[model samples]
Target: MHVVTTPTGQIGRQVVEGLLRAGEPVRVIVRDPSGLSAEVRERVEVVRGSHRELDACMEAFAGADTLFWVVPPTPRADSVVGYYEDSTRAACRAIGARGVKRVVTVSTAGHGIETNAGHLSASLAKDRMIEETGVSFRALQATAFMENLLWQTEAIRHQGAFFWPQPADRVLPVVATRDIAAKATELLLNASWDGRGGVPVVSPDALTPDGMARVVSEVLERPVGYRQLSLDAYREAMIGHGASEAWAQGLVDMAVAQNDGAYDEHHRTAVPSPTGFRQWCEEVLRPAFLA
Candidate 1:
């Protein structure tokens, strides 16, 4: 059995779909099975439970050969690092106990490039804990997701500009989550590789926030521009978006790390995924904005 966690999330859902399409025996651990579409429901065995719970994961992981693990976002957590560590610890224990052989987990771009990088650091730490379980593992290290831009759709449509905490001229490697899912599905379905390593999923061209805005403007046929919001303002905006104070501060720290070249390792070794920023803007962002 191939097990998946957070199977209804953005990347996880795609991973599940890709696995099912390949005619793999799949089981999903979800808190609410109702969230899955009817087609998905009829296809896979559902173990209804949260990944955060150790017993739940143990039950879901039983008889599983490979596991696709994606930690769902916890914006309201009191401590970002604590939440990641705690949940990963649970999964590790479950994996060891259930004798699951392989795992492919969603991780951030910079592994050793930066320390104290809030979310990135936390994800790397999670990777280490998962490794300690002695399961064959692969970390799908993804850069900034293009889907992040969806949060600014209203601002782009109304004010003709979108805002970010980074410098307008600073280029960052970004990936579409679908590409991450596709690569992950390949790994989960095939048991060819062994041991632990990282796969950097990035686009061929790195884009500055300004460059992204220009592409968006061209694609949407509007005069959209990039505006650099102050870090203080960015933190405030994160809180306003329902993130806890600690979580918002963690995001601010992550932005600082990004600006400070934390993702240089990923940029140096990035193998281009098929989707670029412009294609994503045209195919994904455009439709979501218009809708």
Candidate 2:
């Protein structure tokens, strides 16, 4: 049996679909079963509760050989790292108790290079916690997700621009969430690999913010631009959008770390993932913008 957490999320949903398509028996731990698609509801075993709860994890992980883990975000968290530990603490215990053999988790790139990098640091700590359980683990160390730009759809639609704290000229590695899910699905299905390691799921694009803007402009058939926001402005913007002060500050720190080349080491050795920036913009962003 294969178990998935956050089954309704962007990547998790795709992972679940891939597993089902492969004829694997799947189970999912979800806060709301209603969030799952009708097809997913009909197909997989649903353990309705937060994966952070030991009871929920224990129930869902029973008789499961492989597990797909993704820590859901908590934007209002008072302490970013504390929230990650709290969220994964139960699953760590459950993984050992339930005897789930293989584990696949969505994690960030920048494992060794990032310190105090808010969300990135917290994610790495989660990876360590899971590794301590001694289950065969594969950390899908992904770069910035292309889907993250979907959050700026309105800005791109109305203002013909997008914003970020990163420098316009600094090339950043990015990947489509579907590509990440595909990699996870492949690992989950094989069950042949053992031990622990990080898999880099970085795309081939060497695009800076300016380069990304140019791609968007071409795809959208308009003069789209990229604007660099000050760190203070970025933090305040996050807070204004309902994130806690610590969470907002953590985002700022993550941006600072990325700017300082947290993912540089991994990017250097990465075998290019399939999706290109222009391809993603054309397929994903263009439709979202037009909608």
Best by TM-score: 2
Q: Assess every candidate by TM-score.
A: 0.97, 0.98
lDDT of 2 at 73: 83
Expressed as tens digits, the lDDT of each residue in 1-291 for candidate 1 is 899888888899999999999999899989888999999999999988788888888888999999998777799999878888988878899898999999999998875544578888888878889998889999998898889899899999789899889999999778899999999999998888889999888887778998988999999998999999999999999999999998998899898888988777777777789998899999999999989
- Local accuracy of candidate 2 as per-residue lDDT tens digits, 131-234: 99999999999988999899998998889899999999999778999999999999999968999999999988889999999999999999999999999999
Tell me which residue pairs clash in candidate 2.
none
Q: Provide the lDDT at 119 for model 2.
A: 89
RMSD of each: 1.1, 0.9
For model 2, give the 10-residue run with minimal summed lDDT: 109-118
Position 22, candidate 2: lDDT: 92
Score candidate 2 by lDDT.
0.92
Q: After superposition, how far is residue 25 of candidate 1 from its true place, in Å?
A: 1.1
